[model samples]
Target: MHRIVIAFLLSSLSGLAFAHGMSAEDQARILNAGLLEYMQLGATHMLSGYDHLLFLFGVVFFLTRFKDILKFITAFTVGHSITLIVATLLEISANYYLIDAVIALTVCYKAFDNLDGFKRYFQMSSPNLTWMVFAFGLIHGFGLSTRLQQLPLGTDGLVLKILSFNVGVELGQIVALSIMLVILAGWRKTASFERFSKASNIGLMLFGGLLLLMQLHGYQHTQFPDEFPLNTDDHFHIHEDMEAETSPLTNYPNKLNFDDIYSQDEVLHDDNSYQDEHSHDGEDFHSH
Candidate 1:
């Protein structure tokens, strides 16, 4: 059972590992990418977003009715869509690591709620689940916006691009939810699932906490940029030093530029000597 939980986490995080970079090809595609391509990109991003998936999973973990699932999912969708489109259009930027860290905590929050942690530990009624999901959906949308803005979304047809992306996001959500529903269906049939449901939520909570810690670690490195040696321009400096040490390109022994090859006095003397040589050559040619 623990092995199953670990395998699930590893699979989800693998996609997350490549989520943000927006490869050179992806960036180029965004410049001229059509509605369909933008839509595909959106779907791809949502599918790869493990935090979003985990939160959705936590939300639906106990939901048995289709109508309830739709209602909750719709609320989440509306909340995120409002923020995703508005924040993106307004070009509102936030620190991505901080935003993502909050998103990670959202998963933990949901899992904790699923496990009745609030009632057990805090001795308080849990907040309205619907409203809370919607609110966190807004935050999740902002996180999506941050990632989208990394692309060179052109000024023209911006609204269309955003809409297409949103459409793709919905498609991706549907695909992911379908799979979760199938799995949940199969698992709910088993006696083990009844016994391990709490353990499963606990696993979710732990994974979410792990993700949160990773994001915070990233945030700290971002805040103190100097500590991360890889970010510094040390590589360029080293290349320059290597050239200076081992290459004549830095010294330019064969450089043709006047400033590099000739002193002012050398230029003047060369000019005078050239005239003298020309006079001597002319005399010799006439005499011959």
Candidate 2:
């Protein structure tokens, strides 16, 4: 049991690195990709999205009836699909890191709800689960939209492209939920599940917190690169090396070469020098 728990934690942590970022190869390929190719990319994104999967897991963890499952899932599906399509079509955008951070919170929210944390700690009933799930689903879809916008989604057939991708996302969700339901149904028959359900939800919450911190860390690095001791170029290289070492599940023949993406001169400017160059109202404008 201990080994199984350890393995699950390790697997979840490893998945954090590969959560829904497009590689250079992906960007290049999508330049002329057809609807089917777009569908494939969407499915791939959903499958690789660990935060999304974790939230879904928490949503279905307590659902025993097929009708209940169907109702909740349909709500989530409609919610996400609405944002994914509309956001992509309108080119609505936000920082992907920040969006992912909120998605992480959604994961934490679901787990907390599952464990009845509100009632236990606050002596109050939780919000309506189905409505909350739907709201979180909207946020999750926006997260997906942020990633989708990274691709070269041409304007010629943009609507079709978005719809195709949304379809793929649904297909991927169906596959993932099918697997989750099967595992949960089988586990429900065992005594261990009753013994361990609370522990599992707690673990889910911990994982979500970890992901939240990681996303915020990434946001800081990207948005405030000059604040770090190492320049952005060096930091990116360190990340590249770390990814190479840690991610055994993925094979990146065409690894993301940040050299093509980041300009060293632009990112390597000293903070003091930058402050010296720019001032606001006769005072140094310092970044905090």
Candidate 3:
């Protein structure tokens, strides 16, 4: 059972660390799509969003009580929903890679907390779990907002569309959480669960670290592209070379000028015709 949990977490994180948001076609669909379509996009995004799922799993890892789950999830939802709406509406946005980097860290943070890293490493107590989760949710919402902003959301019926999308995200969350809870419940019944709980959370922390590194690397590439070993300068030089090589004048500099050559031919033809006419007149005069 614990084996299943570890495998599931690892596989999900591995996928999440590299997954992109939506495709161009999906973004195009959002341009003229209705509320239901937007809703579907939101639902699909959440369902496929491994980073979000892992963090959520970390959040509910030890919470056996239904009320606690409700409280924590609600706090998280409210926090993210506010920013998702407000940020997109007010046009408040940030670099998504950076936002995602922080989001990845949240997974690490939750996993570390789950394993009591603070007590073990620093001999300190953690903060209020509810408030911290809410805070992290705010950050998560900003990430969501960045994705929504990529869509061509027009002025008309924008609020309704955002609301619908939020609803869909919640729906997706519910479905995912249900499955996770069932898995956890089953694992709890097994005797090995207690033995492996620490290891599982440790695994979660490792996954989070990988995600964090990926996000930071992405951020670095976006911010300082030239720092990478791959020669981007070559790309620019190749473009310039192509432009120069493809120029008409550059390719045929030694070729004769067609306009000038045609003008010269016409002038020579006129001169020959005038000489021939005069010669014909002379011949007629001599014959007479």
User: Each model's TM-score, in the order given?
Assistant: 0.78, 0.78, 0.78
Candidate 3 lDDT, 120-214, residue by residue in tens: 99999998999999999999999999988888888999899889989999999999999899999999999988998888888888888888888
Kindly report which residue stretches of model 3 are placed more than 4 angstroms away from their true locations once superposed: 16-18, 229-288
Supply the global lDDT for candidate 3: 0.88
Against the true structure, candidate 3 reaches a TM-score of 0.78
Candidate 2, run of 10 with poorest lDDT: 1-10
Write down the TM-score for model 2: 0.78
**lDDT scores for all predictions?**
0.86, 0.86, 0.88
C-alpha RMSD values across all candidates: 8.1, 21.0, 7.4
The candidate 3 region of ten consecutive residues with least summed lDDT is: 279-288
Model 1 / residue 69 / CA error / Å: 0.5
Candidates 2 and 3 compared: the better one by lDDT is 3
